[model samples]
Target: MEINLIFKIAAVGILITILGQILKHSGREEHAFLISLAGLILVLTWILPYIYDLFVMIQDLFDL
Candidate 1:
């Protein structure tokens, strides 16, 4: 929800893209794939708490 989190996520994405490209061009396709997957999981871990909070808010709003 904060601007800093958005910047952090964008930085991670950019770093991961650069790393993946370097690994792929060097013929380490598997490592590149793993790097991409790790990046995705890392971003999801950052965002999941926000998603959970949203769900909780919705449930509370509806008296669920």
Candidate 2:
């Protein structure tokens, strides 16, 4: 819900794209794949806390 988080995600995406392209072009397709996977994990780690918080909020709202 913050602009900074959006910017961080966008930056990560852009960095992953660039790094993947470089790895692919250098005949390191495996490395590129790894980079993509790492990027996905990194993003998930960043967002997971917020996701947990959202769930907690929903449960509280419903008195569950």
Whole-model lDDT values for every prediction: 0.97, 0.96
lDDT for model 2 comes to 0.96
Question: In model 2, which residue pairs have backbone atoms overlapping below 3 Å?
Answer: none
How many pairs of residues collide in each model? 0, 0
| lDDT (Cα, tens digit) per residue for candidate 1, span 1-64 | 9999999999999999999999999999999999999999999999999999999999999999
RMSD of 1: 0.7
Best by lDDT: 1
**Candidate 1 at 30: error in angstroms?**
0.4
Regions of candidate 2 where Cα sits further than 4 Å from its true position: none
